[model samples]
Target chain A: MKKALSVIMVVVVMFLASFTVVRSASAEEVKITGVITKIEMAADKKSAIAVLKDNKSGESVTITITDDLTLDKFKDHRIVDGDEIRTKFEKEGDKNISKMFKKTAGC
Target chain B: MSGKIITIMLGCALLTTTVQAKEHPGKEQILKDGYQGPKTCEVCHPGKAKEFLGTVHWKHASKADHVDNLNHKEEHGMKNRIYTMCNGNDIVNNLKEIPPNAAGKTKFSGCNTCHPGDHTIDVGSTGPEAEQSIDCLICHSTKYDFRKRKIVKDDKGNVVMTQDRSTEAAANIGRPSIKNCMVCHEAAGGGALVKRGFSMTKEADVHVSKGIICVDCHQAKNHKIPTGRDPNNWASDGIYMTCVGECHSEKPHKDAGINKHTAKIACQTCHIPRTGGAFSKDFTKWEKMSNGFYEPSTLKREVNETAPVYAWYNLTVSNTPHFIGPKGSRTDGKSKIYPFKLFQGKAYYNKKDGQLLSMDFAPPMATGDTLAGVASAAKILGIKDYEPVPGWQTIYFGSNHQVAPKGKALGCANCHSVNGVLNLKELGYSAKEVEKLTTPEIYFEKLLKLQQENE
Candidate 1:
């Protein structure tokens, strides 16, 4: 009876530790900043995709946007190629992505 | 008895001589003889002949192969054997050709009424003298004597050396009158060929204020005479009125400046009255009445004026860092991120119906958004502000402003603001939406009324 109780406690501790590690690894924040390279919309226009490259790291990233994103507010903000963009993202399952914040380009 | 008989016989002989001299040549003989060419006149009137050659009338004659001695071939296999009635048509072949008769020669008697001169008697070195066929001197009287080659001026300042042989020649024999232009331009059966002319047949009835002669607009030098309808011979130069082309330079509009940036808009777009002739209602009527006549009433009047307008918007999505990741094992994990980016599109509207016409999406890169990549990601999750508005996005609009009387620029709130809750609307909206929805407060009550009536 005593041996069985000790074994159960060890199993519980191991389970908790493994759960914590998985959460930490999956939730890591990834920062991507760059000028957008290309943009494309899905065949049905239900989704939009933006290809971006990190300015400092020179790494390319693809961002997928759903149609529900209300884009009409930034009417005055004209977007074009070579605009510097800074974005923050966290791992969603295995993918690192984030909602965009601020964007600036030459007037 | 012998003296009386001799006198009677001489009288009889004189009568017979007079009768024989009066008899004219037959039509066939006359055509065969042909007119003396203009070159014959050039020997005596070189300066006048040069001036005549410069005239469009002379060009028309040449184009029609009207010159008695010159041989011409139609440019595009056009058969020149057909007959036409009008000298205007024959001189330029401006109209379709008529059929030929059995005589093997086109009867030009009616054509000669305008282009008068006997073709049978006057002979050139090569053939018949063309100048003898009602040529330049028929309109412009000359002072030179062909036999003596000396200029002869009449007592009353007339160049009597040459005669005023044309039916429409001016009595003054100096300047060609507006009557000359009116001969063809005026309405037939006492109708004014050019209705805009100043005179009404009688000199006293002339109204100089009405308008000038055809030459003012139709610049005689540029008069395009149609040789044939063939594409090669077609006149490429477009016709212009007095209000257009280089001379006036003044467009008939107050906001002509707009044309500088985008001249593709036709002038008739705004100056609607001038599209047709004077018989049409003058669009300038509004401008004239507004100056002092029509008094503005307290109640607004609705006018049906439609024009096109364009607008744009952007979306940016952001959030605070929350849970790092799902818990599991030993290795440390990064925070999960859901990126968002901006997309742009144009909406058209019909103000009359208060309905959206269509939406044209700009390519994603054209939005010029730095956050486009991340924002695009958020867009996939339906997490941005100002989602597509159905009727308001694209519409045709109208306005009350008399000058620009098109719909005013659409406000940001029309699409971004939440229905019925102003404060909640302001707070729940995105930062881009909050900024756009705040300004240019529209008279919503008036808009509601207008919109209700339109619907």
Candidate 2:
């Protein structure tokens, strides 16, 4: 019984250390400004994939937006093709998940 | 009572200025250290400096994919291209010196006066040194005095123009507004209301009356402002700003009959019936000089409130230096009827190779030797030989701004009549189609009869 308790304590510490590493990895956020070249809404209308052409580098970046506000904008056509947008996103696995998706404010 | 009120007003103004200064603590350090140029700003906003360096404004060149005559592999822009405004002169060279005979405020400074660089000589250089050459205050500071820019000798003894570097302007910084953009745009093609003919008065544009601004439509990302296929400046990535999907619905008109025209007619066609501001340059005829060079004749026509000529544009722009216009036809499926301000001028072209000669008529306009100018231009372009001849040309400036109110748009009778503004034959329509388009009375009568029968 004493041996089993010691093993359980070791497992709990390992699990907490792994959780801390994951938290640190997800903390890095990137911001970009670009024009939306294309948008693909999910069949369920809960998420979307937006391809933006970076204003400076002229490189294309794909970001997934699952926020309710941005999803409603896509449905109403307020944020459509050719509209310039400024966004903040974080890398999760192989995909970029949008943290903040908004049109580039002007004037 | 008046004396007390004056004191109170002064106190309030000072307090407001102090509060504004406190809001931007980073700028306060600039005031403390004095204006040390772009390097100071780069310390805090390094990302902005890097991003701005890659912009078209900094490089003065980009890929001209929107140009119909250009191959996709080549890169071109305002710096390298010979355009209508100063066609015969070398633009890169002209950035250094304002010709002795330059007109108006340009006499004091060269093209570099409007450029957002510390010195004319450092306009297109790269790396950390080039990053330091950017004059951030000119666009960002409201207090930056435009009059302070003057022609001065650089450390290398090169004649270059420089701008104000006062700590006051450095302390006050913000995003660019319409006022900042107008300082240069209003002065294009020499002086106010000369080139584009855009006016910011409420009467000029309904959008302005409703508190809209230039940047609202010309949205920018990392300083890359998307543009229409203006031959003077083409989009590198073929990205263009559109009104249909952006600010308005694809079909905005309430009437189906009117909405049907949206397929082939652009909004500017009926919306902007007239363009050009007060004293806009309409035509410039260059006459042959005794010295074998051509100079602009005194007989120039300036028009105001001019009617725009209609044309079919399909997003592709002509790259020809002599005559840059939109390339499209009524038969093309993507073509749409658009409005254009046709500016007529005269210049010399090569009779042998059919190349337009860059007329060297900058300073000493009286002795503009066409042959010498041609040789200089040819050397820069790597051309071997040419036979120069005088010729006429026209540049089409798209009518995209100074939009009128919805009610002020063109009426049906404006273009659907025998003596209307639109010329059906010139628009590349079939003879039968022309007759049908010009005779709208028949359609009106048929509609009236149908309505009477229903009643």
Highest-scoring model, TM-score? 2
lDDT of 1 by residue, B228-265 (tens): 11111111122223234433243433343433412322
Alpha-carbon lDDT, every model: 0.30, 0.66
Candidate 1 CAPRI-style tier: incorrect
Q: In candidate 2, which residue ranges exceed 4 Å CA deviation?
A: A1-107, B1-25, B89-92, B98-112, B235-238, B277-304, B320-322, B363-372, B379-384, B440-455
Q: Give RMSD to native, each candidate.
A: 39.0, 27.0
lDDT of 2: 0.66
Clash count for each candidate, listed in order shown: 87, 1
Compared with the true structure, what per-residue lDDT tens digits does model 2 show for residues B1-455? 13443454455445434544554567668877887887778778776776777776666667777676676686565456555554532253354433333223222333445667665435456777667777777777767765555557777867665666788778877656556676666645544555667766556776656555566666778777776655455534335787764446677776678788889898988987877732222113445432232344422122337888888888778766467788889888988989888776566677887766664333324333445655656666677778767666677888887788877788676788888888878889888987888777745775577579989
